[model samples]
Target: MERDKLVYKLKEFQALEAYQVDLFQSQIKSLEDPHIKHAFERFTVREQEHEVFIKDQLYSFNGGTGIVGPAFKFAGMVTGKALDLLSLKDRLKLGIAVEQKAVQMYHEFIEMTRHDPQLKELNKYLSYFMIDEELHQFWFKEHLARIENIEAQPH
Candidate 1:
């Protein structure tokens, strides 16, 4: 991939990571369960790390960390606020859906980097990010199952 195109893609991913960090941070404030809140806090930290990594990559390519688009920023905030009103199970379901999409996006990016020798390091980092997303999706799925199981049990 051309350097300019790669940088553009990196900027997009960086914006996404930033959005995830903000979304998770907002959700953490709304969560009442200590365990779930702690999990979201950890996720927010990891997402921040991912954002920094992408920003570093952008810097290396001379692509300054550009501001996220106002529209995208607004959408993330709205989604996060809407999610805050959902029940725990509904929130977990949405989390699973979002993580699944993120995992797929990372997978596509990893594939794109595969054919370019210069992008190997970026590919490795993306793989790590994908695994983190998968872990998050797994946590959401497990928590949802537990909630469903308890609801199904005889009173």
Candidate 2:
């Protein structure tokens, strides 16, 4: 891929990671469960790391950090607030959907990078990010199932 094109793609991913960080951080503040809040805190940190990694990759190509737009950030915040009003199971379901989309995005990017010799490192990073997203998805699924199971139990 051309340097400019690769940089543009990286910027897009960086913006996404930034949005996720904001969303998770906002949700963490409203979570009453200590375990859930802690998980979100960790997710926020991981997403921040992903953003920084993408920013550094952009810098390597002499591309400036493409700052996420204010409107996008605002949307994430609003979404997080709306999600907080949902039941825990509903929140987890949404989280699973979000993480699944992220995983798919990373997987597609990784496949695109497969034929480009210059993108090997980026491909590796994308794989790592994808795995993290998968883990997040799994966590949400597991918790959602647990919630459903408990609700189904005889009182």
Candidate 3:
């Protein structure tokens, strides 16, 4: 992928991660279920860590390259508002959906770079992201299943 296009998409995605970090943080306080709250706390920290890595990647570029760090930071700050608007169950479902999408996007990026030897390092980094996304999806699904079970029980 071209650096400009790659950086553009990456920064955009990175911002989403930042949004997720915030959302997860809020969930820590809002979630009543101990299991779900614990998971949210775990994911929140992971999201924050990913934000730092994403920031590093975005910062590696200069404006002359048509992709800047500050631009990405601003863009990331704009995402995840919809999560706040969602109900608790819907929020977990949406998170699972988004994480699935993230995995797919990383897969596509990896495939796109398969023919380019220059991007091997990038592919490696993205593979780690793909793994993390999948794990996040699993955790979200687990939380949903647990919540659904709880909701199904008699009061």
Using all chains and alpha carbons, the TM-scores for the candidates as numbered come to: 0.88, 0.87, 0.75
What ranges in model 2 sit over 4 Å off? 65-80
lDDT of 3 by residue, 63-82 (tens): 42554344434322323455
Better of 1 and 2 by TM-score: 1
Question: Which regions of candidate 3 deviate over 4 angstroms?
Answer: 63-87, 153-155
What does candidate 2's lDDT look like per residue over 18-109, in tens digits? 77787788788778899998999999899999989987887887546454333222223346457668877777887787788788878988
Clash numbers, per candidate: 0, 0, 1
Model 1: lowest-lDDT 10 consecutive positions: 68-77
Assess candidate 3 and give its lDDT.
0.73
Ranking by lDDT: 1, 2, 3
Q: What is the Å distance of residue 11 in model 3 from its true position?
A: 1.7
Displacement of the residue 6 alpha carbon in candidate 2, Å: 1.2
> Which residue segments of model 1 deviate by more than 4 Å?
65-80
What is the alpha-carbon lDDT of model 2 when measured against the actual structure? 0.79
Model 2 Cα shift for residue 141 (angstroms): 0.5
